[model samples]
Target: GRRIRKGAKMTYTTTYHSPLGIITLASDGEYLTGLWFNDQKYFGSTLTHNSIDKELPIFIQTKAWLDIYFNGEIPTFLPPLRYNTTVFREMVWNILLTIPYGTVITYKDIAQEIAKQTGQKSMSAQAIGGAVGHNPISLIIPCHRVVGTSGSLTGYAGGLNRKNELLQREKVNMTNLFVPSKKNL
Candidate 1:
């Protein structure tokens, strides 16, 4: 599949302090490209060539979305996404939309949903995990809603603590929503 590129458009990067920690948000002229923790280990190996400015649309929209989300409101982000991935990744992201606000789903369930749509019962949950991790626009895409099969916090590129905070802030009952393989506290 062909990958979408941001091209020659200018990008802006900013760090916002949330309850989770410092989050780095990057945006092109039209939409948001990245949102992750500053100290996040998963993104440390990725190149940081994008510049930071305050004039991008994503910068404004991201800040607004963060405000609404932190205030215990369901954020409705419409930022343009530079999704660069395979057809499967795009399909996975589309399925992610069906997961409503303040709800959680396991990676296996996501894979099963995708399999139901595509009629491929052999799809692996690990592949779905890859798509979830590669999601560029975070909260809007709602990747945090994906958890472990045993209802554990599993691996979040944004960090498990941040993921827990997000789920908790959204008022998701962890005991009911997750299987409790491990506790943060």
Candidate 2:
């Protein structure tokens, strides 16, 4: 994950129309800083400065990436990204990037990976969930590929329905995955 520079100002934004909904993309002129569903929980939470509505090359590349994704194919390239998060969250988000298309991993799985990386005895799945939910870049980062243990679909900031749809579009098997009940949500 990359950090926003101290003197960086004037975040730029642009919107893309997607099957799930309107998505807002933010950039610091050269690198993508954020991508979120318009109505997502914690949408733009990482943005520290006001954004102006303008399209940058990064946004165009991202939209092209989304276009290919929505057409049911994985884009061979990745747009430049600058993650705005703490080190732990950045580590979690980096793991999210490794989840292949049409596959899923549990929060517990991520927690275990983090624990292994840090040489800790254990890591909290709930903490992993928090990091996953706060992911600044959505589809491209693949945060929707994360799930709970026991096949439960949980903690998607973009809404469970959108999460499910994104997975299905990637051709992920949904036979075992289920949206959790209200209490779990």
Best by TM-score: 2
Query: Which lDDT tens digits does candidate 2 get at residues 1-185?
Result: 55677876878989999988999998888899889999999898756667788877899999999999999999999999997669999999999999999999999999999999999999999999999988889999999999988999888999999999999999999999999989866
Candidate 1's TM-score: 0.82
Alpha-carbon TM-score of each model against the true structure: 0.82, 0.94
Error at 130, model 1, angstroms: 1.8
After superposing candidate 2 on the true structure, give the runs of residues whose Cα lies further than 4 Å from its correct spot.
Answer: 1-8
Backbone-clash count (model 2): 0
The TM-score between candidate 2 and the true structure equals 0.94
Clashing residue pairs, candidate 1? 13-52, 151-179
Worst lDDT run of 10 residues, candidate 2, spans: 1-10
Per-prediction RMSD in angstroms? Answer: 4.5, 3.0
